[model samples]
Target chain A: MLDLNNIGQRYGKKQVLSDLTHRFESGVSVITGPSGVGKTTLLRLCASAERPSQGEVRWCGEVLSRTPRAFRAGLGYAPQRIDFPEDITGMDFLLHMAALKKIGLREAKSQGRALLDRLGLGRDADGRIRTYSGGMRRRLGLAQAFLGAPDILILDEPTAELDPQTAGHVNDLIFEKDAIVLMTTHLAESLSGRSFATLNIPMAQAD
Target chain B: MTLFFESLATHTRIQLSRHLRSPAIWILALAAPIAARFMLPEQGGDYSIMSINSAYLALDPATIGLQLGVIMAVILTPLAYIFLRAGPTRRQPWQADDLTPARRTAQMLGHWIADTVSLWVLMLVLGLAGVVISLFRLPLSDVRPIVTLLCLCLIAAPALAVIAGLRTIFSTRRGLRGAGGDVLFFFVWLALLLLSSAFFATRSAPPILDVFGFAAPLAGTTTERIESLVIFGPASSGDVLSLDAWSGVMSGDYLFSRLFWLVSVGVLVALFAQIYAPHKFKALRPEIVTTGPPSFSKEPVPLASANGSLISLFLSEIQLVLRPRIMIPVLLIVAAAGVVLPFRGMVGPALALLLTFPFSQQAARWRGMEMSKLSALTPLGSSAVFVRLVAMVVLSTALCLPSLVNITASGATDQMLDIVAIGLGLPLLLTALGYLTRSAVTGRLIALILWYGYLNI
Candidate 1:
């Protein structure tokens, strides 16, 4: 379980997320809002990628800040803007991420191949990310997030810039995961049949 | 023509706004004049028996102008390339305006104008600061110092225009874009400085080819102390001069030479831009086709046990640092220089010191990327950073090997230890400092300064 108690985030003089309290169990939680409405901020806060300006985040009663390394062990995140080091091949990047996640090389190779094959990037796995197109890079981002199948998943706009069919496959992968999933997205129709909770960030709070 | 002017105006505003907001620009603006003041202290101030500042302080207005001009020249010359490195036009958003040749010319002109305008503003601030410093250091009756400094600042406009034009051409040219180009420019600046110092020593008016316009102005000054000017040497003795009304700077020869170089460089940039404009941009290509997602098997592969490999992480870090293929040839050349140059004394060690610039920049970039969300979220966390540090140390050691081989063969444990310290220590220090400060330019600048010091030592 993940718990947020009155979390607030400010960048310079601008307040992005304020007094946001939320709880998550093992299920999909969609954060929906207009552009610049702090959905990404909320998701980033939950992933422990950024600390809240005020209040605390707890993962299973352990404060995230206190046990970030351990918390990261069970966390999987895909940011809204996917930025991969351009020089490394997709397979190499995943393998590196796998090593970070404590997956053995032998197992990582198999898992990376399977995931790449699933995402239609098997043909280009050995090519550098610099050569990969936007959609291909997006798929690579999703593949890494889904690498170890950690207990908590925080994905922002995972299906964005993807074809409808690819987006549906990504949605299925997200819904099928037996973990606490927190994500922000614009496509509501994609998640219509799935049982999930919605967190709406009002437009008024944005700068 | 209207559209061109409109585009130029729009780009000028955008670029100027960006310049105003950049912390680097602000830092340079405040630091340049302050550095100048420190370089030229109060005349006849108390100093140690061997100190040069006392002699530098005793310089006439022409020498002072030359010093100020050198300071500004070095700062502004590299700045043109550094700004390009930081903000590459290739990264700009694809706009419809880019398709029109007139608008493209306008955009390039706007960039040049913005650079010149900002540089002029900085020069004015530096001039005012110089005047303020003069008020404290000089008597009110001696305004030649003030006039000389201000006139140099004005003469600097033409010099800066040329520098900005060359920067535009450099940007447009292929194979002259990265650290290679920057390193080349540094040598070019050194050559110009040498030539200018030679002209000053000869007491001859530097012809229209004076890249740094100050050479001609200093040559035309009334003070016979021009021969005492040294390119990177400690201040030698020169007879102290009493206050005299110096009007040599207002001469037509100096003004015409500066104008001539400025117009030549400006025309070259315009012609080069027109010639290369057609081949500059490539059409966006379509991406590869995506296949349908794979069918998921009912029973999934079991999760792998939690046991990360530091070796893999280290290798990936090495790959990241070595990503730019140019570094491969550069490293080979550094090693060759170390081998070909005599291993005795400082020669080999000096070659090893050269590796610090490229490696530190690459390492800083690698560490800088750690702050990003993509890497920060990874479970390896600080362990990955540790692995990268080890990687840098290993690479630094490899760079030292050519120097190390000679020291090792000589049986001089002391020199071997010295090689190891420089090899493993400086790059690590520079890279860590760069990461802490989050500016590759800071690291590169510090490395070069330290490298210069090490060479002189």
Candidate 2:
């Protein structure tokens, strides 16, 4: 379980998120809102990528700040913006990320190849990431997030640049994964039938 | 420990692969050797170990090794720092590496080791070149080329390692992440070079201060202190003092100093890793804590006014060039120069160095902004670039006015032309290179090498 207890975030003089409290259980939770309502910030907090300004983010029963490395071990995150190193190939980038995740090289190679094939990036895997299209880079990010089979996944707009068929494939993977999955997306209407909690940022912040 | 080694290996492989593929690195690898080969004297030229004579000491392998050691020490620190600055360290957070479960210390040390390995690889290339140059310049029967190569490695390797460690510590540590740190390092290098010079002039300085490990080894070969040493220039008319440089390098003091620096650098890097392991392991900085109560509003931030004349544009460009972070250091340097400018021998060269800083940095920053792409779409078009270039040169010149005034008041007016030439020429050259390569890195790397050369002069 991931818990946000009265968390707030301020950038300079502006408050982006204020007094936002929520708890995520062991299942899929979809976050949706208009742009710039702190949905990505919420996800970043949950992923232990950034600390909340005023309150605590707890993973399981332990505070995320106290043991970020341990929290991160179980957490996989894909940020909205894709700013990969332009000099590296997509496959090498994945392998580098795998090394950070402490995955063995041989296992990472097999799993990374499979992930690339599944995400339709297998043909461009050897090409430099600078050559990758927006959708391809997004898929590469998704593939990295799915690597190591982490216990928690926080993805921001995972299906934004993906095609409809690829987006459907991604939804299926998200739903099938046996982990605490949190994602921010605008496809709430299409995903209406799914067994997941919808946490709207405006509503949550208002409360 | 397993994870530690894994991260180290991963970082080393990634950094090496990235650097190895660069055309600049390849060009430099080829260029440095070829350049050095031409600088050496032709066969049957008089050479000595301690003082450079007619042959510029080319045949003496140990002297060449010592010179190589000192030069590498000067060059590698900034090179490693540039590599780290340009590489993945700047963009790791955006790449999702920030969320890694791996220990921060491990990651930091891994980066340090990776940078060190890159420096060593570069050193090996240059060392091999030195070996080839030495063998080519001297008859095999006249000198033991193998011993010379080993001596070069022995002196230069530890120096490069020390530089790599210092670069890692300075570039990675939080508190030391700005122009102040750069200035501090420049002074440190300058001071060390001065110490080596002093040691060359008077062989009485302690061995431990011999950062290059060059002084003590060469001290025994000649008891007569060298009043002046010239390299790669017209040979001096002094009597040539020839001694076996290999035996001197084998002496106990030189070996101890080399070991001392190597061990000290390793310990210092380890201590830095243990103490300053990034923001993850540390508490949030005070700057992040907003003192005032947080205000909530959906109001959009105000944008800069677009209605501006060419003068206004130039002013704004100057403002960008002298942003507070840059201004503070420039002002500080000006303040220091005010006191030091009266000294006759120091004023001209010191002013030249001071004048060159802003132009080089601005050129590097201008390249980094990639503003050329954005400027093409503006109505002003090329005028905007002209304004920026003029602003950089004029503002950089204005900043040096205090020292320039001092030079004129001291009746050293002739030196003003030299300062102005360097001040104006370097930026134009660097900016041209930036435009040519479309990279912020190449011009800065060339500027760094030129900066070292100026220091030698």
Candidate 3:
């Protein structure tokens, strides 16, 4: 189980989240909320994109503050915005991510190739990412997050900038991952038939 | 025309206001004149142009202004250019609200005018402050020279614009991403322009850039034209009053020449603007396709079998440095220079600088590295990441191996170890400094100083 206990985040004077406490078991947990409601911040905190200002986040009863590097490797994150190296191929980008995760180059290459093929980006593997379409870029972001096979996969606004059909495919791909999935979405109705724990966060109070 | 003028005024005001808030701008603008006034030799035995208005020597009022104007413009233009950038440190993408090419060009001209005027305003204030101080501290007479210098500097507004206009045109042509190169190009071009006027004394044979040179005209004909402005001074008047003998406050007017130079430079600036208007700038800074997936060569990255995490970090950092096309030729040239430059004593220092190049560049290009953010998240500790970054510098600097072998073959062992020490040490120092400061300028400045010192050895 992943636990977010009394987590709060403040950027200067503005409080983005306050006294947020939650526990998540090993399955898909969709965090749904309106904009500026700290959904991304919650996702970030879970992904070790941050350490909570007020309280500790724990994975499997181990406080994330124990060993940050180890904690970070266990967590995979796909940010709301993608700003990857535009000159490299999707395959190359994944291999680099693999290396950052301490995966050996041979395994990184093969695994990276497999991930590309699975994500339907294998044909465009040789092309620079700058040539990638918005949907393709989103898929590549997901592919990169899946690199090194983290135990917890976190994605924020993964369906953004994609058409409904493509968005459905992306959503399906997210659910297909074996890891404990944590995701945020603006369109809660899109997941009407899906069975998962839904966490709703209210809009943050102004400072 | 009203729109153009209006846009111009707005840009000037905006640029000026931005710079006014920066203490860097204030120092760059005002510090020199204040320092010069204080540093000028009290006894004034020196007859150099720099000390013309000093206590011991007195030249014509107009000559004083002309000297101060030229020096002030040279110092302030580049500093102003640095401080005036919208995003000097990082590359900014094109914004929707940006002015159109033609209007932006006009606005840039206005912006340059503002920078020049600001320099004049600050310079006048400092000059007056200095004169008041000089009255008490140094034995001096006549506020006319200081006042006259201020007027001349103000009159040379068009000349300053020529310098600033070239900067604008270059910046527009290169885009914000390449503006740093344009800044360097401006300075180098300035140096060469000054040197060319001396080498090719005959004005008839204009070099490729001499057309632009005539617009600013600081060293060559500009000085000749300005000399006539000091008609009352001994240098221009000659026979009766030697500069040494002239005591009282004296002045002359350069209104006609100032107007002529101003008009001439203004025409060149207008031409420059039209030639490099945003649309034309698109031609100048053509979009480059630098990479195409690198064709996926199966060449081993030297760490396929090495399973250590530190080794992985090293490989990634090296990849970042070698990836850019802009860096490759410079590395090749440095290697070539190391091998081919015939001088014996010069080889070591030159190679030291050469070896430091990639390291310095890597330090500057840290943002692009995978280790930058992910290191904190990965199992690899911060120390391992730091070591790997330093290792990239050490390993890449070994590109000088061929040149190093050549140096040994030529039998210059007196400073061989010393050369190698400096070659390795300079980059390491720069890497640490660059990482600490997160500044490209820091790395470049350290390299410059290191090269300058070792070259003199």
TM for every model, in the order presented, reads 0.83, 0.57, 0.68
- Models sorted by TM-score, best on top: 1, 3, 2
Against the true structure, whose DockQ is highest?
1
* Residue range A1-207, candidate 1, lDDT tens digits: 999998889999898888878888899999888988788888888888889998899999998989888888888888866656554578988887787777777888898887777776777787777677677788888888887768998988988988787788778778888999998888888887889998887887566
Deviation from native of the Cα of residue B182 in model 1, angstroms:
2.5
**Residue pairs of candidate 1 with colliding backbone atoms:** none
Q: After superposing candidate 2, which stretches have Cα over 4 Å from the reference?
A: A1-207, B43-55, B58-64, B74-99, B140-145, B201-208, B238-240, B277-312, B325-361, B369-385, B398-412, B418-457
Model 2's CAPRI class is incorrect
In model 2, pairs of residues that clash are none
lDDT of 1 by residue, B1-457 (tens): 7787898898878777777777767786788678557655665444211122224434445445545665566555556445544532323443444465555566667767777677777776666666666656666665465665756564577767766675666566555543554555656666766676676556664556567765565455445554353333343453353322234456676667767776777677767767543333321232233355434333343455557677767776666667556767767676656554544445544554556555555555434343355667777756766676788788767766776666666665666655655666766776676566544544564566456545654
lDDT of 2 by residue, B53-125 (tens): 3324435777666666545654455555555555434334423445677665565566666666666776677
Q: After superposition, how far is residue B195 of candidate 2 from its true place, in Å?
A: 3.7
Docking class of 1: acceptable
lDDT of 1 at B292: 56
Query: How do the candidates rank by lDDT, highest first?
Result: 1, 2, 3
Report candidate 1's interface RMSD in Å: 4.3
